[model samples]
Target chain A: MATVASNQRGTGSRLKTWWTILKISLEERFVYRGDFALGTLMRFLPIITQVFLWYAIFAASGKEKIEAYTANGVVAYYMLTMISRAFSSMPGLCSGIALQVRDGEIKKYLIQPIDLLGFLLLTRIAHKLCYYVIALIPFTFVFFLCRGFFENGWPEASVLCAYFLSLIMGFLLGFFMEASLGLVSFWFLEVTSLAFVYNLLNFFLSGHMFPLDLLPDWAAQFINLLPFQYLAYYPAAIFQGTIEPNQVWQGMALEACWLMAFIMIARIMLNRGIHRYSGFGG
Target chain B: MTGYRPSYLNVFLTFARNSLVRDMSFRANFILQCISTISWTVMNIGFYLIVFQYTDSIGKETGWGRNEFFVFLATTWIINSLVQTFFMPNAQQFSELIRSGNLDFALLKPIDTQFVISFPRVDWAALSNLFVGFTLLCYSLYQLTTKAENPLIIDWRSILMYPFYIGCGTVIMYSVMITLAATSVWLGRNQTLYNFWFYITNFSRYPMEIYKVGWGMALWVFFTFIIPVLLVVNIPARIMARPLNTMNSQMWQLAGFAILATVACLMISRRIFVRALKSYRSASS
Candidate 1:
C-alpha cells in the first residue's frame, strides 16, 4: 500500500468506512435469521415474568401507587427498561473485549490502519441500531396491546426524547468503561473476574430490573457517583417521570458529563494498554 | 492417515476431558461464575418475593400465591440452568467453530467431529444455577408445607417422576441447541445463531405458564419441535405436582419428546454436517 497524505479526506474516508462497516455487519446479521425470529420472541419472556412481579406488587399494596408511581406508570417504566435493555451492550461488549484479548486477536488490530477501539465501538452502535429496530416492532405491539398502557403527554414525549439521547449516552458510558476494564487483559490473561464485578455493579447501579427510586437514599447516592446510573437510571427516571421534567435537563447534562469523562478515560487506558501489549498472547 | 475414525465412546471422553481442563485452567472463573449466576438467580428470587408481598395473586382468577410461584419458578430455574450447562455452551460454540473455519480443526481429529464439537466446553459456574434451583425447591416446599391448608410432604411417587421430568427437559433443550448449531452449516459464517440462542435461553428462566394458552401452545411447539425447552422445565414441574393424564400432557409429552428429540438431533445433525462438509471449500477459498 502506498503512503497516503492525511487531509480533510481522512475524516470523510473514515466516515465512509464506518458506513461500510454497518453494511457488512447487517449482512453478517442475516445469517442468523433463524435466531432473529424465535430469539426476538424469547427475549420478551423475561419482561413477562417481570411484569407479573410488578403486578403482584400492585395487587399487594391494594393501591395503584408505590412510592408515587401509578400502576400504569410502573408498567410503562419496566416496558421502557426492557426496550432499552434490548439496546444494551454493556456486559456483552465487556466480555467480548476480554475474549478478543485472551485469544490474541487484539494483536491483529494493532497492525491495521484504522483505530481498533473506534471500529469496535462504532460496530456495536451500528449493530444495535439494526437489532433494536427489530426489537421496536414487538415493543410497540405490546405497548399498544395492553389496555391503559399510555405514553403520558407532550411533556412525556419530550422527556422520552431526552431519555433516548440519554440512552445513547448510557451505552457510550458503558462501552468506554468496559473497554477500559477490558484493557486490563494486557496484564491478565483473563479479565472475567473484573468483568463479573463490573456486571454486578451494572445490574445494581444501572437500575435494569428496578429503578433507582426503588433504592434507599444512601443507596441512590452511592450509585449516583458512578457512571452506571447514567447508563440505565437517568434514562429510566426520565421515562417514568420519577425525576420530574422540570429537572430532566439536569439528568441530560449529567449524562453528557459522564460520557465525556468515560471517553477520555478510555483513550488513556487504550494508549497505556497498547504500550504494554507485550505480544506474548494466547 | 486420512481415513481414521474413533469410537463414539472415545470421542465423548475426549471432549469431556478437554472441556473440563479448559474450565479448570481458570480456577477463579468457576467461583466467580458461580457467584454471578447465583446472584442473578437470587435477584429474581428477590423480585418474586417483592411481587408476592403485594397483590397476593394475579388477575384474581389464576390466584397463584407466593408458594405456588416459588414452586413454579424453582422448577423453571433448575431446568433452565441444567440446560445452560449441558447444551447451550456447546451449541453456541458449534456456530463459532463453523464460522471461524475451526470446524476443520475439529474434523481433523480422530473422533467424530460432531461429538468433539458438541461438548467441548462447560460452564462450571452455571452449575450454581442448579444448586440455587434445588435450594429454591426446598424453600418452596417448606413454604408450601407451612402455608398450605394441607401440608403436603414430598412423596416417593412425585420424587420418582421428577427425574423423569428432568430427563425429558434435558432431551428437549439439547435437541434445540443441536438444531441451531446445525444451522451454522448453511449459514456459511455467522455467529448470530449463538447470540440468538443465548437471548432465547433466558425464556426458561421465567415461569413458562405466563404465556396465553394459544401462545403457550405455540411456545410448546417452539420449545418441543423448535426450541423444545419444556422438555426440561414443564415436565419436571408436572411430575412433582403428580403424574400426567389427558388433562396435562406434559409428562407424557416429555416421555415421547425425549426419545424423539434425541434421535432427531443426532440424525439430522449428522445429515446436515455431512452435507455441509461436502459443499464447504473452507478457508482456503
Candidate 2:
C-alpha cells in the first residue's frame, strides 16, 4: 500500500508538470487573440459555400432525402463536423514538427528531461483548449443560426459521451499520424511535398470536403475500415445518431485501435529517425 | 533609368528563367511537387465522380451537367494553377519580406515594385496542374460535343476569346492575392492569409448559380460587385460550355463585364497596396 501511494504521488507530480506547460501554452496562444478569433470565423466561410451548394442540390432535386440524409440532417452533420474538426485539426503542427526534426532542434528535447511526445501532446491539448475558448462564441452563433436545419434537436446523453470519446481519440489519432509524417524529415532533406501530399489525402479521405456517407457504398465501407473516418466522419455520424447505439461501442473501439496504431507508428518512426539523425553543425 | 528598366518583358523572362533554374536544381523535389499537385486534382475528380452519381447536375437550372461542370472544374484548375504558380509563392513571402525589411530593398529596385515582388519566383510544379486541367477540359469538351442533345459549337471566335478571359481570371486572382498579402503591413504578421485566400476563392470554383438562393444573394452581390470573383471562372466556363444560341449576346456581355471587373479589381487592389505601403514602417521603426 505504501509503494502504491508512492507511485501515485509520482504520477501526480508528472501530470502537474504537464499541466503547468499546458497553462503556459494557453497563455502563449492569447498573444494572437484577434488572429485566433478572425481565423476561426473565416474558416467557416467554406462551410457556408458548401451549405449553398447543398441547398441548391436539394432544391433542384426536390427530394426530401438523398441517400438516407434529409437536408436538415446533412446540415446537422456539417455542424457536428466543425466540432470534430476543431478537435482534430492541428494547423502547422506537422510542418512544425518536421522543421524541428530537419533543423536538429529535436536535440533539445533529447538533452532536456522532458519527453518530446508528452510535451507535444500537452501543448496540443492546451492549443485545443484555448482554441475552443476563443471559438465557442462563434460556434454558438453559427449553431444557433443553423438550429432550424437540425431535424433532431439534441442527441442522447449516451451518444454525446461516445461522440466526445471519439473526438478525443480523433485528436490523438490526428496528432500521431502527423507526427509520424513529420518524423520522415530525418530521412528526407525536404518534406514539403510529402506534407502537401499528406494534406491532400487527409483533406479528402477525412471527409472534410463532404460526408463520407455520401460516397458510394463500397467506398464508404472501405473508408470506414480506415482510420481517417474516425477523424471527422465517425464522430459526426455518432452525434447525428446515424450509427445505432449498439454500433457506438464498436466504433469507439475501432477509434481506440487506430489511435493505438498511430501511436505505435509515431514511436517507431521517432526511434528510427533519432538513430539516423545527424547534426548539421556543431 | 537602366535602359528603360530592362523592358518589362525582359525582366519577367529573366525572373522566370532564374526560377526555372532554381527549380531544376532540386529535381526530385520538383518531381514530387508535380506528383502532389496532380494527385490533388485527381482526388478532387474522384470526389465529384461520387457526387455526380447521385445528382445529374451540379446546378440543374444552370445546366452544369457532368461534362459542363467538369469544364468549369477544368477552368478553375487552369486559373488557380496560374495564380498558384506565378503569384501565390510571392504573396506568401510578402509577410516575411516585410518582417525582414526586404521590402525596402524591393522599393529601391529600378523596376516596378509590384512586378518585382509578384514574379520573383515561378513555381514550375504548379504548371503540372495546367497540363492536367487542359487535358480534362479537352476531354470534357469532346464528351459534350459528341454526347449532348444539342452539341456545342466551338467557333474560331470563342476559341480566340478563351485565352483572353483566362487572362482576366488570372489578373483578378492576382489582384485579390496581392491585396490580401498587403494586409501584412498593418496586421504585423498575416499568417491567416492562406486560409482567407482559400475561403474567398472557394466560391470561384463552383457555378455562380448556386449562390442565387436566400442569403446567397448577398454573397453573390458581395463576390460579384465587391470582390468580382464570380466573373473569374463563370465567364470563361460559360463561354466554353454554353450553346452557341445562348452564348451570342450573353457572351459579349460577360466578356465585357469580365474585362471591366478585372480593371476595377486591379485598380482597387493597387490603391490598397499603395495605401498599405504608405502605412508600412521599416523593421527598425
CAPRI grade, predicted model 2: medium
Give candidate 2 misplaced runs (Cα > 4 Å): A1-9, A272-282, B1-5, B248-252
Report the number of clashing residue pairs per model: 9, 0
How many clashes (backbone atoms < 3 Å, residues ≥3 apart in a chain or on different chains) does model 1 have?
Answer: 9
Candidate 2's residue-wise lDDT over A1-282, tens digit each? 998998889798888888899999999988888767877777677877778778777776767888768877777788788888888888788888888987788899888767888899899998898888899888888888879878888888988898888898889898998888877887886777778877787788887878888887887888888888877888998888788889889878887888888899888888887888877676
**Model 1 Cα displacement at B198 (Å)?**
3.9
What are the chain A TM-scores for all the models, listed individually? 0.88, 0.93
lDDT by residue (tens digit), candidate 1, B123-160? 66687888888898888778766764765566786787
Q: TM-score chain B for all models.
A: 0.79, 0.95
Error of 2 at A63 (Å): 2.4
Candidate 2 lDDT, B95-197, residue by residue in tens: 8899888789898888778888889899999999999999999999999888747887787776877888999999999999999999999988887789889
